[model samples]
Target: MTEHATAVAALTPAIADGPQTIKVIISGGFAAVYRDMLPEFERSTGISVETGSGASEGAGPKTIRHQLANGTKADVVILSREGLHKLNEDGRIRAGSEAGLATAPLAAAVRTGSRKPDIGNDVALRKALIDAGQVVAPSSTSGQYVRDKVFPRLNLPDTVRLTLEARGTEAAEALRAGKANLSIGPTSELVQESGIEVVGLLPPDLQLVQTFTAAIVSDAQAPEAAKRLIDFLSLDSDILLAAIKRAGMERPRG
Candidate 1:
C-alpha cells in the first residue's frame, strides 16, 4: 500500500460502527500542528480522522462545497474564521457547531541565511521593503492587510512590489528560492515550511489577526467524533493553538 493508504489502513481498526470515523478536511495551515496529535486522539476514543492540507481561506470551504455538491463525504472542516462563517451561512456547515480555534497574526519571514530586514518601525519598515528586490505574500487575508494597511501606513506602497501567492506556503517557497527577499503570511503558515526564519511579527500597530475556526458539518458521518474533534480544538492541550503560536501566532483571549 502507498503511504496514504497505509495511514488510512492504520486508522481503519479504530473506526467504530456507531461513532464511525470522522472524515475531516482541514486546511494545510493547521495540518502540521494537528498531525502529531491525531494518534493520541484516535487511541483514546477509537475515532479515526482523515485530514487534507493545502489551500487557504475560502479554498477549504470551496472544496467542501464541491464535495457536498457531488455527495462526497466530509464530517468536519477547519479553516479561516471567515470561511467557516461563510460555509455556515450557506448551510454547508452547521450554524451552531462553529467554533473558534485560534488566531494567527500576519508576519514577515526571511529565507534562512538571508539578510534580515528591519520591520520594527514605520520608517525602518519602509526602508526594508525598498531595499528588498521582491516580496511574496498571499492575495487574501495577510496580503490584504499588508497592501491595504501596512504599506500605506509605512508610506512604502511604491517601495516593494507585492507578489500575491495563491496559497500561504507558496510565499515561503518564493523566499526559499530567493525569488523574493521576503515572505509574509499567517504566522502559522510561515512557520511550517522549512528554510525560513520568521523575521518577527509586523509590529502590533501593523498586525492583523486572522482567526482560524473549526466546525462540525451538518451532514457529518460521525457526529460524535466530529464533536470530539471540536472539543479537542478548544482545549489548551490540543496543540492547535500552540502550533499556531509556534508558527508565529499571538495568544488569543477567551
Candidate 2:
C-alpha cells in the first residue's frame, strides 16, 4: 500500500465502533476550514462531528473560555496558541497534546465597492489610517496587536477614529452597516464576509500572525477519535494544505 494510505489505515483501529460522535469547541479563526473539512472526515472515518464556535476574545459568555467554564462538553478544542496554553495550564486539555494547526495574518478591508486604500508600506498605512473617517477592529488578538504594537510604532493614534467590536465578523459588520470605513482582523474572518472586500495582508513589518492550535480535552469521552481528527487536520497531507489555503490561512511554519 502507498505510504499515505498505510498511515491512514493504521488509524482505523482508533476509530470508535458504531458511528461515534465527537464534540468540538472552536474559535472563529479556524472555524471556517474545520466546518468545510468535517464532511470529508465523516465520510472517511464514519464519525459524526458536532461543533460550537465563539469569538477568540471578549468578556462575553460566548467565548470559548466561558463556554468551557460553564461545563460545556468538548472532545476537542481549537483556539489561539496563547489561549490553548492558558487552558492547558488550567488543566482543561491534555498536557503535550496540543498541536499547531495554521497561522492567519491580519488583513484590512473596506465596504464593497469602496475605494481600496493604499497600505503597502508603513508610511502609506499610517496615512491611510490617519485619513480614514472611522476604523473598526475586533476586540481580540489582532485588535490588541494593532492597538498596542502597531499604533505605538506609528505614533499616530489620534489620527484615526477606532471602534472595537466583540467578534472578528463584527468588524465587517460595522463596515456593512456604514458605521466604519475600514475594518481590520484576521484574513480568514475578513474574506468570509460578503459585504467587505479584503484589501490584503498588513505589511510584513507591522503584521501579526496568530497561530492556532488544537488539543484533545482532558476529560474527553472520545480522546482517540479526537486525536485522529486532529491528525486529519494537520498539514501532513496536501489535501489539508489546500483546504487551509482555501480557508484563507497558511500552514504553520517553523
Candidate 3:
C-alpha cells in the first residue's frame, strides 16, 4: 500500500465501532467550512457529524470568559484564538490540542438585486452599514471585532444599527428575510446564505483576519473519533480544504 494508505491503516485501530457519529460544537468563523465539508467527510470515513454554530450567546458567552463561566459540552470546539485561549485557560480543552484552522476576513453581503456598495475603506464601510436599514451580526468574536475595533476606527458608531445578535446560520437568515439590508460577519457566514450576494471582503488594510482554532474537548466520549475529524478537517489534500478557500477562507495550519 502507498504511504498514505499505510497511514490511514495505522490510525484505524483507534476508530470506534458502534457509531461514527461525532457530536461537535463549532463557533467563531470555521463553522461554515466544516458544514460545507460534512457530506464529503461522511462519505469517506463513514463518520457522522452533528454541528451547531453560533456567537458567544449561542456558543456559550460573549467571551471565552463566558464559555468558562458557564460549562459547555461538545466533542470539539472551533472558535477564535481569544475564545480558544479562554477555553484552554479554563481547562475546557487540551492545552496543545488547539491549532489554527483557517483565517477569514470580515465581509459584506447585500440582497442579490440591490446595488452593491463599496466597503473598500473605513468611510465606505461606515456608509454602507448606515445606509442599510438593518444589519445582522453575531455577538461572537467577529461581532466583537467589528463592534470594538472596526466601527470605532471608521467613526460610524451611531450610523449603523444592529438588528439581530444571532449566531452562524441565523445571521445569514436575517439577511435573507430583508430583516437586515447587509450582513456583516465572517466570510463563511456570508457565503452560506443562499438569498444574499456576497459584495466582497473587507479591505485587507481594515480586515479583521480571524484565526479560528480547533480543540478536542477535555473529556470527549469519542476522543479518537474527534481527533480523526480534526485531522480530516485539517488535511491539506482534502477537497473540503479547497472548498473553504473557494468560500474565501484560509485553510487550517499547524
Model 3 TM: 0.82
Report every candidate's CA lDDT: 0.69, 0.81, 0.71
Off by over 4 Å in 1: 1-16, 58-72, 157-159, 238-245
Give candidate 3 misplaced runs (Cα > 4 Å): 1-13, 16-20, 56-72, 252-254
What are the per-residue Cα lDDT tens digits for candidate 3 across 1-254? 33322344455555757457777777757766777766766666666788755353334454444544566557877788777766676777865676677888888888788899998876777788888857777777777777777767776656577754757576777777878898888887777668788998887777877788778888777777777777766656556567778767886444
Q: lDDT by residue for model 2 over 89-166, one digit each (tens)?
A: 778888777889999998889989988989999998888888776989987777878888888898886657778887
Overall local distance difference test of candidate 1: 0.69
Name the top lDDT candidate.
2
How good is model 1 by TM-score? 0.81
Return the lDDT, model 2, position 98: 85
lDDT of 3 at 94: 64
Model 1, 7-104: lDDT tens digits are 43444343355545778877655655567557766666667777754343423433444455567678888777765666677788876887777678
- Once fitted onto the true fold, the runs of candidate 2 whose alpha carbons sit more than 4 angstroms away are 1-7, 157-159
TM-score of each: 0.81, 0.91, 0.82
- Rank the candidate models, highest lDDT first: 2, 3, 1
